[model samples]
Target: MRRPRYYTPTEVSLHNTIDDLWVSYLGRVYNLTPLVEEYKGNILLKPIIENAGKDISHWFDPETKDIRTHIDPISRCVKYYTPRGRFVHVPPPCPRSDWVNDFGKPWWRDGRFEVGLLTAKTRWIRIINTLTSQEQMLEVCSEDTLDEILQCYLYYNSHAASYTWKYDGVNLDMSKTLSENGIPDKDEEFYQCLMDRDLYTESICLYFNDDLSEI
Candidate 1:
C-alpha cells in the first residue's frame, strides 16, 4: 500500500471555487466536486457549497445537532411522486455511499477522491522583546504567508501605545516562511534575540522572527 500524501493549506486554498470544491475534515482532504454535482438541487447542498475548500470538521461532528438536522431528514425521507401516472418513491438527496461513520469518516473509502492530508499544525507563539520587555503572541501556521504573520502581529500590537518596533529576524521579503527566517518551532520554547538596526547592538529579544528580507 502506498503512503498517503500530505497537502499544505496553501494548496487547499487554491481550490476554493465551486467548480473545484475541496474540503478538509479531521486532517483528511476530500474532493467534493462530485458531491456538489449530485446534490445540486437539494437544499442540503447549501452548507457544502458555502464551505467549499475549507476545513469543515467542526460542522460535521456526530454530537452536534446541526449535522443531525441537516443529514437525518435527507437521509430518512422517502417521498412519493407521480410520474407518468405512476407513483414512485423519490430517494433522499444524500447518497447512501456518502454517509459518514461516527467520527465523520466517509463511507466511500476509495482513494480516488482522497486528495491529501493536512500536514501543518497551527501554533500560538508568544513573542517578547528583550529591549522593551514587551510580549505578545499570535496564532500562526507553518503555511501562513509572511504578510499574514506580520498583519497578525500588527493587529495585536497596534494600540493606543506607539513604539517604533522592528522585527529583528525578519527582512523585507514577505514571501518566505517563518521557518526559513529562523523562527523556532513551538516545541523549542526558547527566546530569540531581536536586534535594533539603528543601535547596531543585540539588545532586543523576540520569541520568533523571520530574516527573509536579509536573505
Candidate 2:
C-alpha cells in the first residue's frame, strides 16, 4: 500500500477556489470543493469561501475533534459557535422549518473530505540530478523521510530510487527524516531562500547508480 501523502500549508493554500477549496483543521487537511459546489449559492458558505485554503483549527475543539460550540444566550441551548457565521451542515441556533439535517454526516465529520494530514512544519530543499545537471526545489514536510521525499522527486526523475541520495558527501538514510540524516533545517532564514535560492537552499545531490532494474 502507498503511504498517506503529507501536505504543507503552502500547498494547501494553492487550492483556494470555489471549485477547489481546501482547509486544514485540527492537524488534518480537507477538500471542501464538493461541499461548496453542492451548496454553491448558500449564504452559509460565505465564511468558508472567504477562508478557503486556510487553517480553520480555531473553528474546532481539539479535544472533541469537532466544531466548537457554546450555550446560546437567547435559545439557552448549545449551538455551533461560528463567530465567522453559520456554515454548511451546521444547524441553526433556533429551529427553522426550512432547515434540514438529512445529510447523513456533516462534511467535517465525513471521511470523504479528508485528504491528508497537515504537516507539523514545512521546509524547502533542492534536489539536484548530477547526471542530467537538472535541479528542482521542493517544499516538503519535516516529518517526511528520504524515501517519502524520493516519491516527490519521482516527477522530476522517474529513476530517483536508482540514484544515490547524498548530503554533504555522506549517504542519506532512506528511512530517516532530513534532520535525522544530519541535514540542518534553515527555517529561520528560509525566506532568504526566495531572494537567493541557491545561496540558502539546502541541496541533496543524486548520483545515478545504473541497475538492471532500469528497463
Candidate 3:
C-alpha cells in the first residue's frame, strides 16, 4: 500500500507574494511564496502538495475540508520583520551561544543569524531599488528563499570566522544518502530533512567566503 500525503491551506494562497504559511504545529507563521513561485519552486514543495490531496482545504479554506499540512517555504518567511528601522537586520540574538561540535572543534552556530541578515539585506535591496524607480535591481521574493540564502550566508560566515578549520568535517552529506537509501515508494521525508540541513549549513559556509570579496 502507498503512504498518505499531507497538504496545507497556505500553499493554496501561495500563487503570489502571500505571507504567513501557518503551521498548526509550530504556532508561528512561515513564508512560503518564494518556495512556490521563486527559488524555482523549491524541489520539496511540489511533492508534499501533490501527495496531500484536495482535503487540505479544511485547515484554512472553508470550501474544502482537506487537512492541509505543509506549505510553500517562501510564503512562510514574511512573518519575520527587519526590526526597528534598520537597513541591516541582525540574527535573532541568543543568550546562549549556538555552539556546535563540528570540524573536530567547537564552532558558533551562525546559520540562523546569517539567514536573518541576508533576508533583511535582500528585502532592503528590493525596497531601495523600488524607491529609485530602478528596474527592480534586487530580486523580489518570498520567504522560502531564506533557507537557501541562509545556507550561503553561513557558509561564508563560517569560513571567514574559522578559515583554518576544515569544513567537510562539519558538513552533513545529504546528497549521498538519497543514493544509498533509495526508497522510491516513500516520500523520504526523514532523509530530505537531513539533506536540507546539510545543504543549508554547508552552503552557508561557501556563501560567507564568496561575500568577503565584495567587502
Highest-scoring model, lDDT: 2
Instruction: Write the residue-wise lDDT of candidate 2 on 148-185 in tens digits.
Output: 99988888777888889999999999999999999998
CA RMSD, predictions in order: 13.4, 3.4, 24.0
After TM-score superposition, the amount by which residue 173's alpha carbon in candidate 2 deviates from its true location, in angstroms, is 2.7
Give residue 206's error in model 3 in angstroms: 8.1
TM-score of candidate 1 on Cα atoms, chains taken together:
0.39
Candidate number that wins on lDDT, 2 or 3: 2
Candidate 3 residue lDDT tens string, 7-62 = 23333234232232222211112333333343333443442234221222223323
Q: Which ten residues in a row are the worst by lDDT in model 2?
A: 190-199
- How do the predictions measure up, each by TM-score? 0.39, 0.83, 0.16
List clash counts for every candidate, in order.
8, 0, 41
Error of 2 at 12 (Å): 0.6
Tens digit per residue, CA lDDT, model 1, 94-130: 4687443453333224456778778667545555555
Instruction: Give me the runs in candidate 1 sitting further than 4 Å from their true place.
Output: 62-112, 122-215
